[model samples]
Target: MAGKRTNSNLAGELLIELRRDDAVPLHRQIEASIRAGVRSGRLPLGSSLPPTRAIAADLGVSRGVIVEAYQQLVAEGYLTSRPGGYTQVAIGPEPAAEPVRTEPKRVPRIDFGYGRADVSSFPRAAWLRSIRRVLTEAPNDRFGYLNGRGVPELHDAIADYLNRVRGTSADPGDVVICNGYAQGVSLLVQVLVRSGAKRLAVEDPSADDDVRPVAVAAGLEVVGIPVDRDGVRVDALDRTDADALVLTPSHQWPTGGVLSAESRAAVLKWAGDRGALVIEDDYDAEYRYDRAPIGAMQGLAPDRVVYAGTASKTLAPGLRLAWLVVPRRLVGDVVQAKVAADRGSPVIDQLTFADFLSRGEFDRHLRRMRPVYRRRRDVLLEALRDRTPGLEPAGIAAGLHLVAWLPDDLSETAVVETAARRGLGVYGVGPYRMSGGGPGGLIFGYSTLSERTITDGIAMLAEVIDEVRAG
Candidate 1:
């Protein structure tokens, strides 16, 4: 049995006896066994652990039981994750392997770093049909550079949708299309900074470490405004002459609380009082689980709020489609920023997406993804409550992933180390810091994962946690 897995004597199989005791939690016990497997190298370097479903099926236990166990392992640094799957022994017990090859940077298995649209359930078939019809009626040899400001029809369609749906004071003329939110973010920042707004206030708990740097690179000073449970505390605005602020008023990233009406009004009033501007990231706006989405803040104060959003969350990030709704006065400046940056995006993408949204396929896509994400959210909740001990997930109602705060004694580094050992792509929320301690937690993205994967993945995570707790 040199390199073969012998179920009876192997560490991965020792869990059968551990499960016999009903008093002990199955996940922790399973975790202990997995740890033994790693230490002994019965699960050799770069080896794959049975996924949660496989483990659950073998143990005749619920997948949630497995999810809890895996969560512990992820916390313990016994797993490393990849997109679509994770590897158990990829990181290995030691730096024992010799260099066998050289490679470019490995794309992360699960990219929790970037906020993405849950497009797994997008109405692709319907979208394809629309594209087919449009293409069929098109002129021959039709592949040419598109209109500079996006197709007229798509702009009109997006205008109608935004005004009706999000309640922004946007006409087709007011909207400037770009490749995605990042581009929109950069363009808007340049316009304001170029307009003499030197400093911009932002939330500490935010997704755009990129945006802040992007702003700086575009020649604006970045300032932090702490976010309260109700949203960015308006009172915390940097006490300077800064004239612009960036916020996700609808669903704040990472923490996932909507701006309270009081807070929302306060921010608007601040903008008005200071004659400042607001950069609104309407991120993950459509997928609300526990409550209806609070209407976009742009609706409340049209002149001061510069609304920005993208199809990255609702459709696929690959579409690279997003919009910036600047005040009528800022349009020329922002469009110029766009023109300078990339001479406008591929005209065809704008045409296709505008057609996609206008025909109502985009809305249909959102509706389809809502229930799927809701189910995944529920599964995550149930997994944590029933299986994950000492772990808590906040921001439950919306967004693709939930943030799980680790216990006070848990080391973020250890959690990361344990996850690497197991091939689980777990990340600490504050690990992205240029400076400062963030809430010690993992941002578990559940959108791209199937239920079984979520169940299994969480089980892997639970295992790391159990190992750490025992230590």
Candidate 2:
């Protein structure tokens, strides 16, 4: 009886154990063991239960005991008996495994980290209206899988908007909508590397951090060309064998140098001579405060440039909306890459954004946000000038953030960590560099902070800086 067995493999797998030495009755022990299996998901929904006689014979218990255990489970809804004479598990417990929970770490009260948008200012009423209108009016076909080139309506809207605002020659056919700027870079890098391109040049002390690793992962070498006040040093670019260049020409990130007209022309000339590509990251150009925004370098030579733009700064990063203006020759390959990445972005969001753009709400939102950000930028500049006389803040003329070059002796990490301890959030530009060595500087983003918060955070940051400088 102790060696009793069954032909059922599942019965063998369950290996139900009975404790005869314990105080519990045999029938009760069998019931408890099977019940634990069901609750723990060791017994799956719809799995056949061994026949009562077979189970009783295998466990060396009386057949009536097995029948009673089965009856109890059936009444408890854990097993279902069918008219066809099959008894199976009725309920399956959810898997107990989950990511372990931990205490939330402390966050700085005022975070100056870049790439953050003011979620509170996200024009919710306008967005909701756009969503409703799209849902009400979109054809049934709009919900189906789409071409990788994106929805034609969004392509047309983006083409018109960029042509008017960024001065780029974008034919509607040449635009490919992507999830965001990050995905756009990934797609482009994939295409470029597969096409036999070997090296890419990124501006040092640039916002190229996110894109560089993507390119390198695709088996291409990324070189760092130093950027000066006028933008990426083209004179130095001539020395590297880089086959493509990713630049923030309109407003250099972290550095804020608008690629000079001279530098812009030089880079294009360099590309043309080498038959190379220039990726123009036209990020945050719409927010320039001191002058009329510089026209996108893509406008100068669209055939040689790939223009990238995003709503991350203009609207919200949560929107995950961005577009690329590819040269006609590269459109097909870029579209293919996009399709393979995710079969294009979500269609409903694309349609909603198209509606938003067509209704002029996108432009209106930008207009409303410009003054608010400009005032904050002004406050930041003035505060830095008044309290931190030794630090020089540059890139203030444009973009949501600027870089303040610290004194040579002060380390960027020391100031950043001290500021965090004081409940202020800010970052150093050192991580953005491709190489270890660069100027000692800190980057501060003002788009998400209010005027009062900016003033207070800067005051606290100044004290931290003074402490770093003193010690």
Candidate 3:
């Protein structure tokens, strides 16, 4: 049965449709229809509903059915009524409009997008073992809300690991566990802003998409310092009025250049002289192919550098686990900001990671994957040489990605567009630059791609480049 009622106060008429053959009670159907109408704004707030008897007569249903529906709705606060007053819609939330639809992003056939790890190599068995151990052995309090500094077990493990492996002079007390690198940077940005820092200098041709916006959103003027083959230009940075500088000194992003000893010392001296802070993003320092990974710059000036590290590159980005070794002076403020941003990282994950680290499972996993990544990197370099002879791949000494310099005459945009049309996803270095004039290049990430796939992708990219050059 269908019934319609017009209320003067409502913008439109309320319509109810009843399915007579369905097993659901007729009263429930009527109640649901009225609730939907109210929520969708067909029956506006304070709009009088039809009398029970009138609606019952209109729908050809028993008067008791209408009365029961009205009574239930009234009890649920969807309607209001008094003995002498008209039954009307009670105060409720504003109507929910239909959601806006957007086109889904297309996934390229062979994506060389950076910042992804080999997820297939994620040690599932070891992770499960750690989780099981945590669940079985952890104290009852381990499940409770932890302080923003994270669990002590994890802190101790990280401190020990960093000191022994990365040569960081980390203390458990100075570690602030965060969700990932992005959040760690965000939290640090907050502390920097709160400490009266007005400008933040980042490595130009760095991860601008990730770090710059975070600084900008926090009202800090972001300055771009040029990065060459030996990481960030310390001379250029010395000229900037930036209060803090964030650099990937271990293995620079995209460029893959390890900051030289002279540059590191110079930058630290500059920081010391200006009373500024340096943020060390130790990104992709684990899978160094040519030599032992450089020790974190934070160790040189623990009080001056805020070192950030993450498991995203080594294990999987899905874990969303990373940590910051903040200086003692900024520890309290960073912890407070972390609490305000997110009460804390998940306790279970932290406990599990702590267990994993203590047991040397993390070390074993890295040992196993390091050679695999090295092989892939070699394959990528070989493919570039064999297929794209004109392009010179730099920054291959470390990191998951490297910059393949395009010829001076080639337009980065044209090559990128042509590669996209061919279902080959290669990123150009043009977007990462804030201010610089240099030859255009493509950023090729090999971590997620297999050797065969990397070879094929490079061949495909070569054809695309040829097409672009011909045009």
Candidate 4:
């Protein structure tokens, strides 16, 4: 009888084919199959192949043929192996084309970008301690899916902290944790739109450009009210037919003005009379150097005002943690929206932050950073006073940044461009305005810069202003 014919099939679903009658040797044929699989994207990079013994037994060939084929592919840079590890595909597929920019971006030597905190002071040790405690003490179920409103521990912690620090009458049941201020606003806007709100009003010349796009995308008409030294003008707000208003009462953006007491009362009254809602974005309320920060407006009328606060200013923006104290009637709607936006914010982070707040670590970190930021603000003001007397810094009593009025002779765009050419980063206020009638100015954020760096950047800015004026 003829000898038993050898099987031709390979195993482990590697998508390899063998030709028994071809003149080429079995080892070379196996190598070609693997090469074709890799080149045609069938075998992805970093994917492991079957063992030599398994493939040899399936193909009814000697193990040496399989070993030689793998060795050859390895030598050609298509496979990688170690003493005990499985061989894997080593080469990457061809790259796709990427879009090109008309002008290359320049990395500035002294950057004064706004909306950033001193990330170098993040209190990593305290955070690590909190995380360790959670892992050791928390129940196993804590790692699973959580309530959209947030965990009870974080809700209680945020409520207690806000009541004591921000003067808000927040109940744990009414607090909804969100990704950040951006998501907080987006969720609330969706709720408002669903409730038949047609128009929303915001501060003109506001630094927070994020709110407009979110509101518009959700099908709400956004109206702009002018802002002055006392914050958003109540007169302009009274004139609009807006069903809801969002403003930074404690420390306004870009302009850096605190809403006057009379105006705050008037705003609450306006909301009550019109049967509307007010969103109090209490961002950057912890760094007031002149005196104690003002209590949140939400304290006066909890049912009519929505209190929004975030860790981005006090801790770090990368945390993406924030809270909204909703009215009792609106809590359910907002939580439903939160569930739809994302199941909820990360639970581990929420628990870690709750532990951080409960142990008083959050308060201690803020106390340490308050003076550091205050000193940076003073140094920036002093440098501007000495180097560029023509520039006047406003809204310096609070927040991480302030706006300086540029002289009438120098154009805002011209000064910003000329400063960029000198390796300095400065932003103009005109772009933040809804309608253009205000004086030209530049916004300087000093929270992330050292005192020495602030001085040097101001000196460079002064020279750039002079050059622009001469031309």
Best-matching candidate per TM-score: 3
* TM-score of each model, paired residue for residue: 0.73, 0.82, 0.83, 0.82
* Worst lDDT 10-window in candidate 3: 1-10
List, residue by residue over 57-143, the lDDT tens digit for candidate 4.
878899999999999999999988998877878886656568775787899999999889899999999999999999899888988
Among these predicted structures, which one has the highest lDDT?
4
Q: Mind giving the per-residue lDDT tens digits that candidate 3 earns over 316-352?
A: 9999999999999999999999999989999999999
What shift in Å separates residue 259 of candidate 3 from its native position after superposition?
A: 0.8
Candidate 2 C-alpha lDDT tens digits along 1-471: 242232365677556788889898877887888888889887877778788888888889889998898889899999888665767878988667899999888899988878666778999999999999989999999889999988998999999999998899999999999999999999999999889999989999777757877988899998999888768898999887888999988788778887888888989999999999999988888887888878988888999999999998899998899999999999999999999999999998998999899889999998998999999899988888887777889888888998899888889999998988898888988888777877788898998888888888889988998887788
Clashes (backbone N, CA, C under 3 Å), per candidate, total 45, 0, 0, 0
Off by over 4 Å in 4: 1-103
> What lDDT is reached at residue 329 by model 4?
99
RMSD values for the candidates in order, in angstroms, are: 22.1, 9.1, 8.3, 8.8
Sort by TM-score, top down from the best: 3, 4, 2, 1
Task: Look at candidate 3 and tell me the lDDT of residue 139.
Answer: 97
How far out, in Å, is residue 15 in model 3? Answer: 15
